[model samples]
Each structure stands twice: as structure tokens, then as C-alpha cells.
Target: MRDFRDAKAMAQTLRDALKAKSISVSHSESLELVAKTLGFHDWNVLSAAIQSSQPAAAKSPPALSFNGGTVIPVAPMRDIVFFPQLISPMFVGREKTRRAVESAAANDGRIVVITQRRAEDDDPDFDALYSVGVVADIMNRVELPNGNQKVRVSCGKRVAVVRPAEADFLAAEVVPLEEVRALDTQAFALTSEIFEAYRSSTNTVPPQSLYRYAGEPGVLADVVVQLLEIGVEKMQQALEIRDVVARLETILGWMRAGAPAKAS
Candidate 1:
């Protein structure tokens, strides 16, 4: 059976076949026909609604629980969204963010990272940032000669920043967004499609490590997002999504649409 991609390709083929038959059908009309055949209002609508109807992240992650634990330090990432399994090199110059790093390092090296809603907001308050982010372990830090701090961290898991816990350094109460292991048939299929989409993308050069993460749906979704180098908005959407299947679909859909059609 043809999946969404395959079916779309068939739609294009139908358009070509119609022209070959000397039948008159405009390209846009053909697309509308294709959309109807696929049960959508039009191609534009199908593009957005082609995804699985269910919300994946709404299902709780297996084997993990959110323990706000102690309020880990909070670092506001400007124009960047971090995901688990990805290493991030961040430069800190802001006083609040630097202090947040130092405080987190003094403890268990855990910190909540949330993205500012606007990159230009130098002094971002809680209302200026996105609530969803990742909890990461600050693995290494060095004081640069330029009066800035260079930090390397590995993102752990998705988290929802509940609110600020008043403190001198930036600190936030966060709830861990638990994730489930991908062992189901649907997940396996989604993983396979994401791999294909990544391979097909013209703008992306997937890392060699892609194969290592492909079997695990969650990691695969993250890997594709990291490798594709898409916009921050798209990356944020992918990161906030919890359903391994839905996450994979979003990444795959973006990649598929990003590339131009191959020559026959």
C-alpha cells in the first residue's frame, strides 16, 4: 500500500498520464482531484493534514516520571532549542544566564533550558520565553579570555518549565516530560520513513551517527532535526512533540517538502 508520499507521487503521475492521453486537465485542477481522491479539500489542506490524527505526546512516556526534584538552574537559550541526545556548545555572556550555569555546575550539573520568544530580548522575563524546554547536564565549562563562558552540555529529556523559583541566579521549577521507548510496529515504520526522508533531503547532510539512532524512534526524530538544519520554529515544533510516531512524521514531512523533485 502507498503511504502519503507514495500516494502523492501517484497523483503527479496521474497528472502526466492525463496529459499523455490528450485529455485537458490543468495542473492545479489535477492537484485538486488528487486531494479529493485522498479525501482532503485541496493540496494545501492535505499538506497540513496528512499527518496522523492522534496527538502522540499526549500519551505518557513509559518508564520515566517527572520529579521536579530540586529546582535545577534555568538557562534561557536565545534562538535555539535543545533536544536530548544532542550535544550543544553554548556561549554565555548574559549575567543571569552565566550565573545560572555556575549554580547548576555547583550542584548536579543539571539545568533547565528554555528558548526566549524573541532573540533580541536581552533581559527576558518568564513571559518572554517558551515554557517547554530540555533538562541537560552541563558536562564541561571553561572561562574564555574574552570574558565569556564556553559550555558543553548534553540534553537529557524534554521538560516543561513550571515557573521561576525566586533566587539570585536564574532557577526554575520544571517537570520532566517523560518519553516512551519505541517498540511498536507503527513506530518502526515511522522511523523507516524518517530515514528515507533524511536521505532524500537536498538541503541536509545527515551525520554518520544517523544509523545508530534510527532504531529508536525518539532519538531518530532528534537526529533528523539536528541534521536537517531547519528553522528554529520547526525545530521547536519537533522538540515539543512527544509522540515518537508524530515526531518522526513531522521531521519526515518537513524534509520531504524541503527537497526538489529528482530528475527521472
Candidate 2:
């Protein structure tokens, strides 16, 4: 009684057996054949099943929920783009920014963080920030002696600002942005290349942390994107890309073109 987790090994064995018989099939073709033999429609279906069956600890965080309303406190980032499932620390010093973090922490621990178009815009209005951002959970908050707050957040879902809200801090009504995940053999291979490249590039991220999302390519792409030492605009470009394969391809391209894969 094999499950989706064993599908990849089965496909590999099938390919080897066929090769021994002088029959040649592309890796993707073999994956498709194994998926069909397993009663799944396509490799994508089997891949999705594999992702869904991952252990709870390995799975990406569930999609964000806002029963109260879509309007949430918006914190404009200066130079970083936060991605879902990546827990990163943030520094809040501005009056409005501190209030926003406080408000979210005091309530549901949920907040919408959008990157500012220009990092120098100390007081950016909602219109001055990027429309696409992430909804994150405020994990921990510590007040500093310099009147700043150091907060940690775990991003959950991609979100787009629908409109501005009149609040103490920058606030926005946003809608969740769905990821377009089209996983295939190519994507899986790209993930492997990324892992290898990342290993050769930096030691900031633990190998186990990145390898944990092998079954979930989209999440793995985001995890890799978060560790890249690219500029804000390039990071934003990665954030806006919904397709998993496209995202993975773009990241690999950046790495190959020497776009600095080290995390800052």
C-alpha cells in the first residue's frame, strides 16, 4: 500500500527498469506515466497530493483568515519584502509603525506589511506603498530603550491592498492573493539546483530549514527568495510572481546571473 510520498521513488525505479530494457523516456514523461499508473490524472495532481500529505510540521502555514474584516493595520517596509512562511524580524521606530504593530499584537496578532516604493519615504501613505504585500502573524514583540520595537513575524499569505483606511497607523483593506502553483519534474529539478546553489553560496540559512519544504515547491521558492540578498525591487518581483515554476525559474536565473544569493 504505497502513498503519494513514494510516488517519486516509484517513478525513478520505473525509469531505471525501462532504461535497462533499452526503452528511453524523459524524466517528466516517466513521472507522468507513474502518476497515471497510480490513478492520478497527471503529475501535477500527484504532486499536489504529495504536498497535501506532508507532515503538519513540514507543510506551509494555512491561508490567512480575517473574520473581522479585510482592513488590517499596514506596516510599510523600508527595504525588505516579506514572503509567506518565512519568519523574519522587523524594527519599528516610527510613531505610526509602532502603533500598527501594537494594534495588531494587542488584537489578533495579524497585520498587513507592504514595502514602500522608496525606502526614504519615512511617512509613506498607503498609495505610496506597493499594492502587493503579505499578511503576517506577530510572533513576538520587544520594546527597545531607544523608543523602537523589535518584532518578529511569520508571514502567512500574499495580499493586495484594496484601499486605504483612516487609522492611527497606515491601514488597508486587502484581499488574499492566491498562488498559481504548477509543479512538474522541471520544478522539482529547479528546487534541487537552488538547494545546491544556496549551499555553495551562503551559510546563513541552515540546510534543514530549506530542505524541509521539498514537497511544497511554492513554499520552497518563497523560502529561497527570502534568503536572497537581492534588492527590494527584485524581491518585489519575486513576491508578485504567482506561478511556482516561474518563480523557481526566476530565482535560479538570478542565481546563475550572479544576482547575489546570500541573505542580508
The Cα local distance difference test for each model comes to: 0.72, 0.80
Regions more than 4 Å wrong, model 1: 1-69, 203-207, 259-264
- Prediction 2 TM-score vs. true: 0.69
lDDT of 2 by residue, 1-264 (tens): 767679888889999999999999988789889988987645655664565456768866646554323459989999888888878899999999998988898888899988999999989996588778888999999889997889999888887665577888888766566676546777787888888777667655546867889878888888888777788998998887767888999998887777666553
List, in order, the clash count of every candidate structure.
1, 0
Candidate 1 CA-lDDT value: 0.72
Lowest lDDT sum, 10 consecutive residues, model 2, at 62-71
> Could you report the Cα RMSD, in angstroms, for every candidate shown?
12.5, 12.4
Provide the TM-score for each candidate, comma-separated.
0.70, 0.69
On lDDT, the candidate that comes out on top is 2
What residue pairs clash in candidate 2, if any at all? none
